[model samples]
Target: MTPLGRRLLILFTAVLLLAGLGTGVVLHAAARADRADQPQSGGPAVSTGKLTLGQKGRLAFVNGAAGPHRTAVASVPSTDPRGGRTASDLKCARFYAATGTGVCLQSVTGVLKQSNRALLLDRNLRTLRTFPLAGTPSRARVSPSGRFVAWTVFVSGESYSSAFFSTRTSILDTRTMRLTPSLESFSVVLDGKPYHASDINFWGVTFAKDDDTFYATLNTANRTYLIRGSLSRHTVTTLIQNVECPSLSPDGTRVAFKKRVLSGATLWHEYVLDLTTLHETALAERHSVDDQAAWLDDHTVAYALPANGKVGSSDLWSVPADGKGAPRLLIAGASSPAPS
Candidate 1:
């Protein structure tokens, strides 16, 4: 053959091989997505239905099961959390509700970057308002009186375990339609004296029933502190150290939080802090819990742990608030426990 013909033949062969590899990768990805839509063997049964935030004695969560209903807001009877689930059409990455009001954090893929938003939902799971988010959603909560909402997002790094990340926490008054775009704008009082820093970040806001008081995690100087915030005063004061993701109890007497088990480590153990006495009680769950817990009632606290043998899924587990009992499985294939 001529030298030019030989060179052409080699180039054509290389192009065909590259095309075949690209097709194979596309097919593999499509197959995985197809599998995700099908129901897994022995998974919990879920049905389409109207789910309301005002439904008394029901537990709502983001469904993590593999099926068409995956990522939908689902509910099971609080008395029988293991029973079949009724899933709503609304889907969210994180959700929380109180007194007929709900906050849903959602992410939508765009052509260039992912868009994130928060939806203020009514009792029937209808969108009452929508607020654009600055980054990826991380946490969400509604005040017990249903008059306030708050959420947090990671503005820089994706994971809290990363050494370098920034967060933006926002608060909204549902009745007045007033919004506090960032908690960093509020005045800070660290260890009695006024404090400020460029590296400060706040997240995981849990509100009190009073509608003006809230608690959140404040991070600065490589240390985490629990800060009690007031909406009326536009200020936050440091309460204690090393507390993250504070979830206040039903009666507002204690806060369920995850404390770092060691310095400079991502591991955490859940503990309850007495607001009056300033004492802490470690819960019975021995495994590292990385979620902001939800109070099941005055006596119990619930949180999600990664599901066994399942990727990108979690299960809800509950333990006594007094720190004496073993962790009990509350629901399978679920996360973001919201007890109504």
Candidate 2:
């Protein structure tokens, strides 16, 4: 063969190879996009619609189902949690609503770092205000009267399962627009004495009917404590040890919290603490739950557990607050239960 013919053949072969590689890349990208748009098999049906915190007898949460509505603030009838879900346009990583107010934590990718923020929403699900967050959002709650909102974020490590991590918790009064940037500034009373430490961290705040009273998990010296706090006094007092993510009951007489089952392990079991007697009752849920539980009513508490055979998703379950009944599935492919 002549030299000119050989050179032309080589050039043609290279062009064909590059074209094939480019086509493959495009196909792979398209396939990923399609998967994200499609719903997971056996996932609950969700439709886009208007959702409101003031809707009577409704339960709201962050939709974890894989579909177009994934991560959107979704709601189901409190009486029919297994029924179809109505998703709103607002998306959040964590959310909670009470009375007529909602708090939504969201993250946005930026050029240099991920930007996190919290949106205060009205009864109509409209954004009333936005507050910048210092890190990745983990937990959120609103007071029963809908006057106060609180959120927790991990400033260092992302997971509670990690051996070392730092958190920043903030509370805001919607009526006056007063903000408490971090709970660490509150005076601490540990074991009936004033305490101070650089390692103190607070998270998973749950408020009582009285706006001034709240409960949260306080961690320091490799131990966790349930602390009762007062907004007016700017003070916190340790109540019990080994308690995390306390959720006050609707009646404000009890708190549902996750108790660490194994030392130095991430396993935890749900328990109900009677505020009057300081008695703790182990709940019927045997599975290790790692969520801040929410009260469905005065007698029931709902929380999230990892969905079976699904990654990055969870299912909401409820059991009797008295520790007598078994856990019942409240909602599939959902997290952050906020019942009203």
Candidate 3:
């Protein structure tokens, strides 16, 4: 399909869900019914990725995940104000907030041969400048300290004629722009191989509270797992497995990610795993709802999900930390959810 055709197809599907003209309500009712076997509660009926009581939230997402991708930096107020205003938009890629205010971010631009670029945008979304990366890097995430930046790159050998994939993971000091040398035949990771994997990989990195340690989402073999590592040691251990997303809790004892179950392509559910025990507990299940999870507090986890996956059919929602209440909608059809 053409790029515009694909985009319109995506948007049209989004519209159907938002209008409740799809199976969104039925799916949600079934999910809530499933929770009867779990727990029950009477809290907020709906909590948005958008704030409703002066408690603003931050979510950096590519508004259009399809072709002609446009990076959108959005902040939702405590109140349902204007359906969460867009703070800024970048050249044509995904973005992550470097500062709490969404200042520094890394992005990709089809305009530059899909070259990886670092960006600094003012509060109004004006382009301050763009820094090209050493090699074409992938997505980016800001460190917990808000001072350093970390991203993954596949130091692979793929060309027009040679179409094989073996990507090595790399990190950069966003403040310094210094990249750790590639792992040479197990240079950093001694026990396992470097981050060389087949295609259809979805690896993302995150830092610990100290900004010295890292965590990533790796899909290998037939199962997916979350791995934790340190930049200083360059060694990784399987923190937990059979899960994706790999977002760290503020306290660092729990991880919120989308755990695949049943038929993975049919269902993706939100889960929070205890780091020490590796025990996973489910939150909610809605098709096409995995990708991002944000911790609101030690007991609350917020996420973005599609109320419906039809035309214009996705919405943001959150489930309780204890799995006691039904999943509640926060907003409609958002791709990313970041809690402050």
Off by over 4 Å in 2: 1-3, 6-10
Model 3: per-residue Cα lDDT over 155-237, one tens digit each: 45431112443444445564665665342212223126555543434356766878777677655565566777666665665
lDDT of the candidates, in the order given: 0.95, 0.93, 0.53
Candidates 1 and 3 compared by TM-score, better number: 1
Writing each residue's lDDT as its tens digit, candidate 1 over 1-340 gives: 8999999999999999999999999999999999979879888889999888979889999999999999999999999999899999999999999999999999989899898999999999999999999999999999999999999999999878997999999999999999999999999999999998999999999999888999999999999999999999999999999999999999999999999998888899999999988899999999899999999999999999999898888999999999898999999899998999
The local distance difference test score of model 2 is: 0.93
Tell me the tens digit of each residue's lDDT in model 2 across 131-236: 9999999999999899999999999998889978999999999999999999999999999999999999999999988899999999999999999999999999
Cα lDDT for residue 225, model 2?
A: 97
Which of candidates 1 and 3 reaches a greater lDDT? 1
> TM-score of model 3 relative to the true fold?
0.62
Best by lDDT: 1
Name the regions of candidate 3 deviating beyond 4 angstroms. 1-71, 79-86, 89-92, 98-139, 152-170, 180-202, 263-266, 286-288, 307-314
> What are the TM-scores, per candidate, against the unseen true structure?
0.91, 0.95, 0.62
